[model samples]
Target chain A: MVAFDFISHGFIQKALIGGFFIAMLCSTLGVFLVLRNLSLIGDGLSHVTFGSVAMGLLFKLYPFYIAIPIVMVSAIGIMKLKEKTRLFSDTAIGIVSSLGIASGVFISSIAGGLNIDLFSYLFGNILAINWTEVLVSFFLSLFFIFLIIIFYQELLFITFDEESAQVSGINVKKINTMLYLMTALTVVLAMKAVGVLLVTALLILPPVTALQFSMGFKGTLFISCVIGVLSVTAGIILSFFMDFPTGATIVIINFLFFVLSLLFKKIF
Target chain B: MKETENVISMQNVYFSYNSAEVLSGVSFDLKKGAFLGIVGPNGSGKTTLIRLMLGFLKPQIGDIYLFGQPAFLFKDWHRIGYLPQKTSFSDNHFPAKVKEIVALGLLSKKRSPKRIFREDLRIIDKYLDLFGIIDLKEKFIGELSGGQRQRVLLAKAMVNEPELLILDEPTTALDPETRERFFDILKEINNKKAMTIIMITHDIGTIGRYASNMLYLDKRVIFFGTFESFCNSNDMTEYFGEFAQHLICHRHDTGDIYKKSYGRI
Candidate 1:
């Protein structure tokens, strides 16, 4: 039996847990994605989540129902588009991302749900963590963990050498599609934690921090998970004193880590 | 030269990038244990042809077969390895140890969650040893010199026990002595491992000295056959003029290459 504190209210506990796994999952993938120059996937997928949410609001359906499929399709489409084009991946992602954000706004305007509390979606609200959000975050994070572990080699290969990876029969296109799909799913679930605008911040910052000192793939993963968990935890604690949103705080924490890494690189 | 089964066959292949034609009407076959050297000027289709064979790019006008099967559908990629021209991206730092970089070759083989298995470790160790890179296993890739980096890239190429090894300018950065040692190791591998090599390079001296077969690309394939035929052709003389004469000269001193043939290479 353990003593309960103010933080032990089921919802607060759930938010913390939800933030923990979402941070871990997003940051892990984000580190590699950012390093690979694919940061726009996080940005684009988050907008797609916003689009899905808008659809849910307009049609009076559950946001998750609309968000999941919209995000997944956009994710898969980005992969195909990148594969078939001569354009660099970042350019493709940027184009697709602009379209995603544009569509979300267009949908919202057409549906006339102009008063939608997009604040919850833009900047994360740890206060809004519900039972369902926690469960979804847990399972999705677990699946992401499985994916990172299983397809770890394929992703590393594709990132390193797409041509050689394809020649080695790794299904480079499909694996990239799966990565985008998983990224979409993670972003939508993490919406309850970090919101849309700041989500990429959490994703990019943690991984960059980990990459600073880590040596290989395993080292990168370990350092990313540690950095991610610590940032979110510290963010939540800071939210108590600063009276600010938890997601914003975590991003600031992550940014600080990035700065620290750069300083360390410069100093010693 | 004989009608033995080919490892790679390209028929009338055409490829373009951004509407600029690269390889046009290119067709060739790689024998099971031949070192096919592709040499050309900067803008030639050497890299493009390799990409098409690797199935990373599709030919607009023709077909490519690997291991006697349609290349896109072929799944035995584990037996084929490639070393790209730019082996290290901006992200790859020196802190990545040689063993860690080499282990990436087995990524397609192992799908488990645990740390790399003993068998995987053994294979990596074997390639490291075979490449004479065992001592550098713990060294960071960034810390190593260019020749060392090139050696590490070769080890990465062979780490998966690939039967067909494709290299894009494998010795491009090495000094002349280092290049000789690198080719010697490649010669040894050709004999011992029976590996089929497809290489794209610009150094005529090294290519003339080391390669058994030649595929000369010039926006289109200019020639494809034994080094003797490619070097001594009247068409090659008309096509490359002075350069063709240079290739013959490069080979003249090394009749040792034509004479000292042993094992597979």
Candidate 2:
């Protein structure tokens, strides 16, 4: 049995609270992205966040202030590239993702090498989350989640059929841009908790696991959020006791849930 | 809202893709309550014309109007119901139910909150029953067969009971019996509700039996008039030859004409 003493630490509390909000946001957005065949967008935007973070560190500025705007712009750029050109969405994502990582490497070399600060961002250090980040994630997640609720029907319509939704008087372009912007914001917030490399795992695994069950869209969304929060909670506690990386632990737990869901689908 | 006599109006519409010139000098006016069938061969701009009318594509040198408003500026979309060629929900595991899919039809008329009240559910069920799929309301859309899926989508399109309905090759993947039933439903809606309808189809032979006006198009408007005129027109007879033109126009008249004219063919 593990002692409850670690629960009193402010850092652990911050990680738990912040991680919960981030997990909820990622999983909620993941459902739409996966259904729309835009799952790779999370991975793509996270790489852009990496380059922005490196630029911030090189300039001695707060990373998120730079990372947020840059990643958002890159997200829109990926969308516009796919629209203007005849390339498929995956190809566009691949192009943007390659540029992001290549630029990060170039910037890092120009700054001499990858330092401990950048390394922390590369692998994540959720325990170092401050009170400000906790509040920010909480409010941001709540705000977007509320927006999702208000536009829930419109989003579902567009995901099902874009042309029919357009005929229904939905501004398909505006809604699509809003979706990309929301994804960019989620990617930036999730980066601090899971790092650039593992952010996609958080955005993908929960919704996919929920999809294994034969349920309605709303049911799938609800189950995805439950899995997300559960994994984060269990991961933070297990990492505290087992001395494992919190981000990796959470991702692993998520994968385990996915595998179990597949097996459950097979058995029942 | 003031009523418009013409449901759609297009004047000298010209469209091209990469200078290929898919459609040129296309002009037509569809009055209210007219059932118009747009038939053409593949790559003949039937779909493009539909897209332009729906404002999905703009013409380089023509004006299009819907309900007397410019097509691009028309905002009363709730008055129009559309069924595309193929829905993206064709994936075998698309996680949406029949009821949920049908509910999407009523969403366009809603305000920001857009909540589906109990009355909306009743309307959805009524449509499902009309389509004979009320029992499948809770089933996933992907789990249904092609015919059932078409019915569900038709229900979705008709749930709003719009003033005008547009269908793009909606029966492309169904059996002949299912297609017949589908057209029967459309005929009923067109006759009973006096709804204006524009359907693009490859079933040129069968479309004449139901559509009041037939627009035979090949890039430009080859013919746009009532089926009676098309049957009696010497130009159509010359263009399609006696056998083929009679084959299309025969069904519009009586079986006696089909037997007397093209029975030996």
Candidate 3:
């Protein structure tokens, strides 16, 4: 009865709704990122978000609005750097990631050290999410879902064999850019639920856990989404009852699911 | 009229990577229903030439036309199929099924939204059966053996019934028996379907058995003519020396065994 009463609160209701969509958004994109060997991109972009957020704070601007364009450009820049230098993708990601964090720290020092607002953004405060963000997350999630559905075959083709896809006249450059931009948008939205530090966990863990089951591609995607939604919902409820930090609890739950999936593969 | 049309035409095409010249003043014309075997040593730009035709690389100097359109601007990709060299990138963990991989060949002909309909599945099944891998359609591609995977990839390339098929060193890693079987399939496709093919190979001895036209490339068009013409050419005799030329022309004479066994060629 106490749990039911806790769930009835308006803030808690908003967090659940918003976190659900965000989880869907992250997990869906995660499957492609992991298979394309760009799983670390979520982590890379979130670091850039941190730097952008610090800039926003210093300028008295809305951090979310500022983070979007900056992170998208940074993502494309990572890709271009890889192409021009022929560096490995991870090397490109690492270069951008370090630059973002180093600049973030530099800006933080200039702003007279970290503040409570920065801490909230860094660690996340999903329980404090308002109705506007909830609606934004919902609509954004739906738009991405629609895009994925239409481009599913194209994505699969390029993921399997990029050269052959190009030979088949699929615009490999456009598809890659679309993927990176969508990932940028997803990372920014997910940061609000899982925090900058733990955002990649949301993007990587569910798909990796689902991969352990050796299902087909479509089945793997479906299972990953289920695990993502389940963890977010369970983590939110458990955190409310136990007085735990919402973001960390969610990540821990995701980690727990991964462990269970590994064991499940071993035993049965 | 269609039979006389040049399926692929290259004129004085030159290509270089960085400062190193790979191909210089290379020229060729391939008519419809021609089976062209591109034979060359390592780094002789055979793969580069194929890439140029597929529009994967742009020629630095001259022009390439495919199905009568400029190679760079060619939009009718469904009319062409390509099998790239097998790489180490197709690891054991890729999660696509055989049918899914085969279905990708059909995607080139589709518009946006690219939905696979029931008719598409039927087409995939036809190709799978044609390649004798219909039973493995539901299995993951990573789990297949080397020959099996090669067959699946070939089926994928042919699923759309492309008029021109380009293969790059497709049999490099196969065993002798598997290589023979692969050539037999190619011969059958060339004869029965009358499909134009451009295959890159390192096997000078065996390439003459299947290729209607031989193109011996070494950074330039060293030789391009019919196999019989190559067998009799005094210039090729001097370029390859007597023994090496005999090794290539000898295979042409003995290829009759294959022709007799197959009976249809």
The chain B TM-scores of all candidates, as shown, are 0.87, 0.92, 0.91
Clashing pairs in 1: B94-B142
Ranking by lDDT: 2, 3, 1
On the 0 to 100 scale, the lDDT of residue B214 in model 3 is: 86
Q: Return the TM-score for each candidate structure.
A: 0.89, 0.95, 0.93
- Which of candidates 1 and 2 is the stronger one according to lDDT? 2
lDDT of 3 at A94: 95
True contacts kept of each: 0.46, 0.72, 0.58
lDDT, candidate 2, B176-199, per-residue tens: 777777778888999999999999
Best by TM-score: 2
Backbone clash pairs for candidate 3 read none
Off by over 4 Å in 3: B1-4, B87-91, B173-175, B250-265
lDDT of each: 0.77, 0.88, 0.87
- Name the best candidate (by lDDT): 2
Better of 1 and 2 by DockQ: 2
The DockQ ranking, best first, is 2, 3, 1
